[model samples]
Target: MIAFENAAYSYGGGELLSEISLRLAPGSFHFLTGPSGSGKSTFLKLCYGELMPTAGRLTLFDREVRALSRDDIALTRRRIGVVHQDCQFLDHLPLAANVALPLTVAGRAAPAADLSDLLGWVGLGQLADALPPSLSGGERQRAALARAIIMGPDVILADEPTGNLDWDLSLRLLTLLVELNRMGKTILIATHDLNLIRQAKSQLAARVLRISKRRIQLAGADL
Candidate 1:
């Protein structure tokens, strides 16, 4: 779990996020909404240890962020999965290999059966042998998701996951995420899509968090 206690982050000597004190409980789902450049991505970076807060304390898995070493952060990141707005892949490698790259880097074995199952779970079963350049936007997004969860991380953090896809494709991705939440993964998605958040609320207990005026606010029914 990630916790921020009165945490504030600064960039170029200016505060970007302030007073962010929130806990991502196990198996919980949350949506972070904010306008462009409102620190949504910055907050996610802090959560995953890419950036440390300038004031107060931010903890990951129980250890204070500032106290963790570089290797410690790498190990901690293995337990947290992230899906970026722009999916990156090895264009020359097959889809399955791209998804399995993390295991390779971690010096772990990639079981063939498990990799197949994961690709199928993300609806990319048939594309396992396809190159990255041949995929559509939604396909690339789903592939990114598959890569994120290949290690079976405890928490999933998605940044504008459905930004480029059409409404139907977006709903498809949402269903996959909801299914993951049911399977007991802590999920936090940073997005500006209100309709997607509203749709998710109807199916599960998802909290809406709005980042406004340099802080995080727990949104009510007004979302």
Candidate 2:
């Protein structure tokens, strides 16, 4: 569903990603691992069209990313769900409204029943009426996930999704991603948690990619 050919990205006269090439097949599951400032987030941004490469080509869902217009990218984003390190939510809005924001921004209204069910799925059913500041870190994360998938996106990209959670909470989030993959949603998660990656491997066939030296390589260990 996504491919990068000899892609390179640079900022402030420094190259963070260089000549990187990758292909994510439809319904495939993959994990991206790297140290801080190692370009994992940069690569994910490139994949989702947030950052255009300085050179080479990035193809997301068949069309070249750089060639896509702003509106085209916005439309394409509806088919791609993204969970960021810091869950972006409207501080004043209720959790349910936050989860439903994607649909609203896309000019579609999600049914009230479906919205409630989705919030329930993320264990936020009761917290739907609460504002973003009232929720804990894990709660916000799940809320973000609910928002991302509410549109029934074909692909899910998560960057440090469980960064603030404990081991148990992290596993819970991982389980949700695995379930999404089982349902044929392509998944790419960027995280520094090797143990989480190992846990994911035990339950699913997830390819591990490590970013280093300005390129991406398949991890050699069973990570």
Candidate 3:
């Protein structure tokens, strides 16, 4: 869970986010919507402690983010999975290795069978040995999701996950996310795709939040 109280983040010339107050409770699913350069990504970064608040307080799992040491932040990240827009990976690494990178970095050994099962669940079972550069856009996104959840984190933070995929692929990714939410994982996705949000609403309850005028607000029913 995460909470922000009058939180503001500033860089270069001015503030990207200001006086924002929000909370993500356990097992809640929320969608973040905003125009380009409107702080959706910045907000996601704050959620996982990638950036500290410049004004007020932001707390993750009941602890003030800025107060955490580097090692503490690293450990805290283990409880939060993040999917980025780019789906970054080592080009030369096989899909299996890429998916297992989190466990590797955490100094935990991944059993081969479990790894295969996870890949299969994400629809990448047959492509485990393929290199990241060889994957299609949707495949890369799914692979990224697989890697993000490999640690079995309590919270999942995804930024523009469906930005590059077609409608079908987006739905597939959304279904996977919905399944995770049903299993009680806290989910927050920052995306510009309103159709995807609407599709998610058809399957599960999801609160939509929009960033406008440098503040976060609940979206109207018009969405």
Give all candidates' CA lDDT scores. Answer: 0.93, 0.92, 0.94
Alpha-carbon shift of residue 195 in model 2 (angstroms): 0.9
RMSD of each: 1.0, 0.8, 0.9
Scored against the true structure, residue 93 in model 3 reaches a CA lDDT of 86
lDDT of 1 by residue, 17-130 (tens): 999899999999999998999999999999999999999999899999999999999999989989988988999999999999889889998899999999998899999999
In candidate 2, stretches whose alpha carbon ends up further than 4 angstroms from where it belongs are none
TM-score, one value per model: 0.97, 0.98, 0.98
Candidate 2 residue lDDT tens string, 34-124: 8899998888888788999999988988999978999999998999999997988999899988999998998889899999998888888
Error of 3 at 65 (Å): 0.7
Tens-digit lDDT track of model 3 for 77-138: 99999998798999988999999999999999999999999999999999999999999999
By TM-score, the candidates rank as 2, 3, 1
In model 1, the runs with Cα more than 4 Å from the true position are none
Q: After superposition, how far is residue 192 of candidate 2 from its true place, in Å?
A: 0.7
